[model samples]
Target: DQQVKQNSPSLSVQEGRISILNCDYTNSMFDYFLWYKKYPAEGPTFLISISSIKDKNEDGRFTVFLNKSAKHLSLHIVPSQPGDSAVYFCAASQTNRDDKIIFGKGTRLHILP
Candidate 1:
């Protein structure tokens, strides 16, 4: 079975700095990787994603990096801000398989002033 894991339960970063969230997976067969941000009582919103063919994908302040060799991936948030504070989850799915997504436990990011 494929499992996504986020070891850190939380991270604290100062405003105007960078925040790095890490994730690891057990299955190399996963073809798609995604990051999602969620607030209390709200569903997670898509942040970014990377395909198995690509190593990196970026959109504005969010970037998703994949390391197929190590079965690892990371999310980078440049110039982190208070508004960026939320619980981030790492997810994986196989495109060829059913659209079942495996999600990590999630990492809560705190932007401190």
Candidate 2:
């Protein structure tokens, strides 16, 4: 079973539009959630993060929401730009000494100009 899964492998949207990415998790023990954006060969950069303690968190054009009961989370980007095209990965980890994170397959977002 996939502890974390990004159902959509890819998403496409026109520039200056809204982009929504979905993610789901199976493990209930995961307390820390994070989203990372990747461009080509470089490693993913931390976009935003939310603890299970909060329902939602937002920063600039990026926002993350967590639903503990449903075991799901999603990322929303407003007025998506062409430069925003990249792979997004959702990760989760337990809040303990072993902060090993589990990542989803990733979602490739293509923003059209």
Candidate 3:
């Protein structure tokens, strides 16, 4: 079974609006959470990340929040733009096992104009 899961296979958001993507994990040992974005042909790139010590991490238009007790995390994009349309993957891993990560099925986000 996948430790990390993205229930929604895709999401649609209006341009200039907020886009919220959710993720959940079954493993309680995961202490780090990360969001990755992938374009049509390019490799997945790091978008945002959070650690168990903190509940949230923000980087410019993107923010990631982690809820340890719930084994949940979310990625928020404010003022969604057309360029933001891509596949996003939620990933988790234990601090000690950084090399072995669990990734959820990517969620395809579409920004409607």
Task: Please give the CA lDDT of all the candidate structures.
Answer: 0.94, 0.95, 0.94
Tens digits of per-residue lDDT, candidate 1, 1-113, equal 43899999999999999999999999878999999999999999998999999999999999888999999999999989899999999999999987688999999999999
In candidate 2, where is summed lDDT lowest over 10 consecutive residues?
93-102
What residue runs in model 1 are displaced by over 4 Å at the alpha carbon? Answer: none
* Stretches > 4 Å off in candidate 2: 97-99
TM-score, one value per model: 0.96, 0.96, 0.96
Across 1-113, the per-residue lDDT of candidate 2 in tens digits comes to: 78999999999999999999999999999999999999998989999999999999999999999999999999999989988999999999998758689999999999998
> Relative to the unseen true structure, what is the C-alpha lDDT of residue 37 in candidate 2, on a scale of 0 to 100?
98
lDDT of 2 at 81: 93
Which scores greater on lDDT, model 2 or model 3? 2
lDDT of 2 at 73: 98
Per-residue alpha-carbon lDDT of candidate 3 for residues 1-113, written as tens digits (9 for 90 to 100): 88999999999999999999999999998998999999998999988889899999999999998988999999999989999999999999998864688899999999999
How many collisions per candidate?
Answer: 0, 0, 0
